[model samples]
Every structure is written in C-alpha cells, then in structure tokens.
Target: MMKVPKGKTVLVKGVASIKGECEVLGARLNFFECEKFVPVFCIEDCEIEINGEFRILDGSTIPESWKKLAKMDWETVFLYGGVDSGKSTLAAYLANKVGGAYVLDLDIGQADIANPGAMGYGFAKDVVSLSKVSMINGFFVGSITPQGREAKCLQGVARLWKELRRLDGRKIVDTTGWVKGRGAKEYKLAKLEIIEPDLIASFEGKPFDWKTFEVEKGYVIRRDKIDRAKARFESYQKFLRGARILELERDRINLKPDLFRGKDVTQFIESVLGV
Candidate 1:
C-alpha cells in the first residue's frame, strides 16, 4: 500500500485497490481491474495498493467542462464521439454525478451494458464501469458494427427508447463511433429524431448542425482491431457462460426480417444444386 498525498492525482491501469478518501471521476474507488488507466484523485490523504501499473500525474485529469456538464439539469443527455474518445468514461462519471441515471448504450460493437451485437440500458445508482451494471433490458441488433445493419440498429434504438421513456430519472445515451460520411450522418440524424435528447454532449468537436456541448477527451487508451475482437470474444463467452438449449415450435418464436416471408424455394435450391 502506498500513501497518496491530498490533492495528488494518480493514473492506475490494471488491478488496484484504494482505501480512505479517494475518488475516481467523483466516485469512490474500491477493488477494480482497470482495463485502461483511470485517474484517481486523492480528496484527502489515501492509501492505494496497486498490482499492475500506475503514473503520478501533475494534476487531475477531469476537465472543468465535464464538471459543468454534470451539474446541468438535462433530463436526457446524448453522448457523441469516436472510438477511444472517452464516451463511456464520461458516461460513468455523469452517471455517478447525476445519481440514479439510466445509461442507454447504443455502441453495439463495444457494448458496456450488453453483449456485442446488442444494445442495452441499466440504472446506474453508482458505477465504476457500465459493463458491471446489470442490464435492465436489451435489444438485439444481430451485428456488431452498424455498417450494413444501420436500419436494424435504429430499430433497436427506437424499441429500447420506448421502454426507457416509461422510467423516471435522468438518461444518458452512449452511441457508436460511426459518425462520418453521408450514410453515417443520415443514420445519426434518424437516431436523433427518435431519441430527441435534451442535451448532446460531443467529444469529437461539433460535428452536428444542432447545438452540442463540446467535451474534452481525457486520458483515453486506444484499442486496436485485435484488442476489440478479443474484447468482443470475452463478452460473448461471459454472456453465454451458462449454456442451455430449448426446443420450441417455429410459430412460437419470432425472427427479425422473417426469413420465411416469401414462398417455398426448396425446389429452386434442389434444381440449382442438381440434388
């Protein structure tokens, strides 16, 4: 255990524990494995026991704008940013600050509240990470990225929002980093139309025509494609850890886009294959 002086800031990556008056983004730090380095500010003199790696920074990494954003009374706040832009970190900070806020994670590729290929929302009374929070509900988008599944992604968003609207308290929405080109622009616009959030907090400058609160991308660790794929694999393993198989009639279950919507094509397939 190491004693941290009051007003000192430390960036910890990997396994660590903190005891005494210390806060990570306005929330108390406990035993946690830092996937990326998270800034821990010593409110008072504290002891931190670390196993992985740490860096004593010059000052706190938390931005003034983030503190200001947290204090606002917006009912619904939408987060816009690219990958590694600290969107999830900001979401967790805001959730901790707002108290009892609901986080709607639409970044299906790197989902925090649900498995890959799906979106989910959870009630965050206090959270160091959204991935640890229990999912209140989820909508399957059937794909990790929103490239070709843009329509399905939007559908999932709308469906999840329908359920989210019924719940009281502030809402924080985190979206994918697919915000470029005309297609991405159109997709985001369609999403905005459905969500209509009171505030749009952007980390990637002001890309939207609508007014947005620009936020600093503080202390982010960029992950490569291999890292992302590995993360997704882990998510899949965790989600399907308790495996079970159940047989149900075809009519009892619903399939999106209904593959059998058209007429019988068994004969055509047989003819083509010469079977």
Candidate 2:
C-alpha cells in the first residue's frame, strides 16, 4: 500500500484496492478491475494497494472535455466511438456523476450488463464498470457481433428503448465500435433514430447529421482480438453459471427464427442413415 496525497491522482489499469476519501469519475473508489484504465482522484490522503499496474500522475488523467460533458444536463445521451475509443468508460463516468442514471449498454460484443450475445440496461448510481451493475433485463441477439445480425440487434435496441422511455431519469447509451463503411453507418443511424438521444457524444468526429459533442479519446487501453475473445468467453461462462434447462410447450412460447417453420427432415435424415 502506498500513500496518495490529497489532490493527487492515480490511474489504475488492473486489479487494485483504494481506501480513503477518493473518487473515480465522481464515484467513490474502493476496488476496480476492468478492461480499461480507471482514474482515482484523492479527495483526501488515501492508501492504494495495487495488484496489477498503476501510474501516479500529476493530476487526474480524465480529459477536460469529459469533465465538461459530465456537467451537461441532458435527459438522454448517446456515446459514439470506434473500438477502444472509451465509450464504456465515458458511460460509466457520466452515470456515476449524474447519479441514478440508466445505462443502456448495446455493445453486444463486449457487453457489460449482459452476456456477449445480448444487450441490457441497468440503473447506475455509482459504478466503476457497467459490468458491476445488475442487469434489469436483456434481449438476446444470439450473436456476439452485429455483422449479419444487424436487423435482430436493431430490433432488440428498439424493444429496449421502448422500456427505457417509460423510466423517468437520465439515460446513457453506450454503443459498439462498428462505425465504418456504409453498412455500419446505416445500422448506427437506425439506432439513433430509435433512441433519439438529446445529445450525441461523438468521440471520432461527426459520424452522422445530428446534434453532437465532439469528445476526445481519453486514457484507454486497446485490446487485441485474442483478448476480446477471451473476455467474451469468460463473460459467457459467468453468465451461464448455475444455469438450468426447462421444457415448455411449443405453442405456449414464442421462438425467434423458428427452425420448425420449414418442412420436416426427420424421415429424410433417417433414410440417409438407414436408421
């Protein structure tokens, strides 16, 4: 454990435990370990016991633009950025600052509130990572990336947006990093149309013709494809822990992309195998 003087800031990238009067992006910091770096500002003298890596900076590493964005009074905010552009980080920061804000996480690939193949939202009062926030509910897209499954993903977003609109509080939407090419553009625009955010915090310039706040990429660590896959696998395991299977009548439940819609192939398969 090392002593952190008041007014000093420590940027921790991995597992660590901070004790004392300190805050991370307006939220009290106690313990944090996530895929991105978290800045811990000492309100008073504190002790931080780190397990992975840390950097003691002159002051907070949080960008001034982020600070300004947090102060803005907007009912709904959408974060737009590419991979590792700090969308999730900004979402967590703004949620903590605003207090009792709803975080609608739509990054199905690296989902925080739900598994990798789903989108979810949760209430955030104070959180270092959205993954720590309990999921209120989620819509399964059945895929990690929104490549060919764009329509399903958009449908899920629209369904979730309907529910979020009923809630009476600040809402922050974090999106995926698939901001490229015509297809990606169309998908993103469709999402924006559904959400109708009051403000769009564009981290990578103006991607669309909307009211946007050009924000800079703050301190962030980029993860490779292997790292991303590992994280997703771990998330899948965590989400499936203590799981159970249930049998229900087909007529009683609705299934997406019902496989039995086509002609039955059981007899053909049996003939081919001579069973």
**Best model number under lDDT:** 2
TM per candidate = 0.87, 0.85
Error of 2 at 119 (Å): 0.6
lDDT of 2 by residue, 1-275 (tens): 99999989888767878889888867986887865467899989999998877888777767888889999978999999999999988898888887769999999999989899999999987787888889998999998899998767877887898999899999999999999899999889878888889999999888888999989997776799998999898888889999999989989998799777743445533332345
Model 2: per-residue Cα lDDT at residue 26: 73
- Residue pairs clashing in model 1 are none
- Model 1, C-alpha of 21: deviation from truth (Å): 1.0
Off by over 4 Å in 1: 33-36, 245-257, 260-275
lDDT of 2: 0.86
Alpha-carbon local distance difference test for all models: 0.84, 0.86
- State the weakest 10-residue window (summed lDDT) of model 2: 265-274
Instruction: Single out the weakest 10-residue window by summed lDDT for candidate 1.
Output: 265-274
Tens-place lDDT per residue, model 1, 1-275, is 99889888888877878887877867876767756677888888889999888989766788888999999879999999888898888998999887668999999999989999999999986666778779999999889899887766776887899899889899999999988789888777778878888889998787778768999888776899999999899889989999999889999898789677743445533332345
